[model samples]
Target: MADPVAAVAALDEPNRRKLYDLVARATCPISKDEAAAAVDLPRTTAAFHLDKLVEMGLLTVVHERRTGRSGPGAGRPAKLYRRSDEQIAVSLPDRRYEAASHLVTDALVEAEQTGEPARVILNRRAYEWGADLAGQAAEADASRGPASNRVTEALARFGFEPLAEGGSILLRNCPFHSLAHRHTELVCGMNLCLISGLLDGIEASGVTAHLDPSPGHCCVRISQAPSSRSPSVSR
Candidate 1:
């Protein structure tokens, strides 16, 4: 199948970004005109690229529907375009993640060699510190009414334009789930550990987690700590 990332890269710079954004936001198929408008490209330009996207199999025309008549009794309705699930598969085929991991890893190395007595342990210490904070918050005296707007407040802190849906909040800003792809359980545990310390009752359990590596998107679930009102379980 055509690589979504590669296909996007093949396009011109700004247009590539525009296409990625369009694919990300559009839930269903769009027409050439709508796709053009979605990317803010001129009609002719949009049309040209739309066909290119289709040819690349990065997008497909899903459905066509009527637009309102231009006159009292206009001709046939306008055609609509949409995105297809078959769009390109964007991935980090390069060593970008490895390079980033090394950067953080090297930071740790430098501290030990040059910094003060405890300097070598910076980022690791930070992660631990952050995890401790998460654990505490989990065990805290925090309260949230289930019927209340739970996500609206949680996402505000994360700096995401939060989207709420049926008791769930989606973080739209992260286009990929980078952390989780490496190790599901490990990342989840890290998240839980940090969040727990950040909350009320929970303390650092130092739990070793088993994780599956699914290199796509990782989900970070944000919820209020389990209330004391509920039946308690062993920490």
Candidate 2:
């Protein structure tokens, strides 16, 4: 996993950020020579910055014979750089909009097929998805295999950013922040059901999910016992 802080720090340099922009905007991989010319920098400077980006996991490199010439004089292969698939997010505290996207999209599809209310389908599917994800994680980590471990990892992988807080795992980020802000009732409801399903899927007898909304924190929090307190999301 790429360190979020380090990834953001790498782009703090002006020239490095410029070079990254060039490569990212390009239709295809760019060479050091091309990048330098585009940014009005020397070949060596561009190469240095490009390599730095690669090291930071912001870009990927490949050796390409771009000339399309075949002979002893074909010359050395050119080094090319392109944007990496790695996602770099530096949300203050942390947030997970992508996870929300996955849940909402899947719910939409499921609703279309079943001819059911979107919210209801979202509730059911979110739990099923969490359970399915836990199963996959368990299979992938057969060695240290405990359902809780797998569940924790799966949540982290989805950018939940779970952190220990007072005998509870406080979710530090809500992947669906914008949606939650606009449709607090609907989104938080989906979130609660989704996490509840996650706990069920993992067979986590030791922990339970609770709806605990706080400013700048995830709406759902995981605690050792299910709380009688139910958080109301405005519909």
Candidate 3:
């Protein structure tokens, strides 16, 4: 019911990182020992941190068992910790995305002024970051679902944190977006088309990328388009 982000904030830094570290790494949910192992904290410390998380409603005890020595006589199993279905989230800083977007968009704007070919500029970026893309390709080879997973992973490689949501994904970090005041149309549209192309290239066809200012999110919107579509990539 309360803001989860606020609750996480209420914690100390190491503790806060511990919590995010849990949600971030959870594959099929986790138990107490699992969470503890995630942060490399002592069992007691992990239990303490987990108790705080439980109190804040971020976690709930699923089941309990007893654990003790078994030399003369063994006890029951030990209780394990798991995350609650409930979740509360915090907003990412828009200024960061906007600033990064500003840089790339500025380059694009400048390219236009100097009459540099557009495709050449875009390809130049992709090539310049070839190693980064190669690393992401290797990561993508490990997952399933639409190309979005790989897209998110690649973006992560590029330093943006993306969260998976319904059909669409949330970009917690934006490496672009700052030139809004000056290069509004070009920069925004460029990012949109760029993401759309990325999705398309990943075989996630029919995915159209859009920037939603209301919730401050950018994501792919899969929908049928007119017969003709431009091949130019962006963002």
Each model's lDDT: 0.45, 0.78, 0.55
Which lDDT tens digits does candidate 2 get at residues 109-170? 87799887777777776667667766776666667466556557767766778887777888
Stretches of candidate 3 off by over 4 Å are 1-135, 139-148, 219-235
User: Considering every candidate listed, which one attains the maximal TM-score?
Assistant: 2
Q: 34-140 in candidate 1: lDDT tens per residue?
A: 76776788888877766666666666654433654476666655554455466344444322343335434665576677774332233243345444544443344
**TM-score against truth, every candidate:** 0.31, 0.70, 0.37
Give, for candidate 3, the lowest lDDT window spanning 10 residues: 219-228
So what's the TM-score on candidate 3? 0.37
lDDT measured at residue 130 in model 3 versus the true structure, 0 to 100: 36
For model 2, give the 10-residue run with minimal summed lDDT: 226-235
C-alpha root-mean-square deviation, each candidate: 15.6, 5.0, 13.1
lDDT of 1: 0.45
RMSD value for candidate 2: 5.0
Q: Write the per-residue lDDT of candidate 3 for residues 1-235, one digit (tens) a residue.
A: 5565667675666864675467546654456677777778777777777777777776666543344355555655555556666766554552344334444665677688888765456544433343344455656576645555566665565444667667555666544545544666554555555555455445544444455543454432333434324344432
For candidate 3, the per-residue lDDT at 102 reads: 46
Please say which candidate is ahead in lDDT: 1 or 2.
2
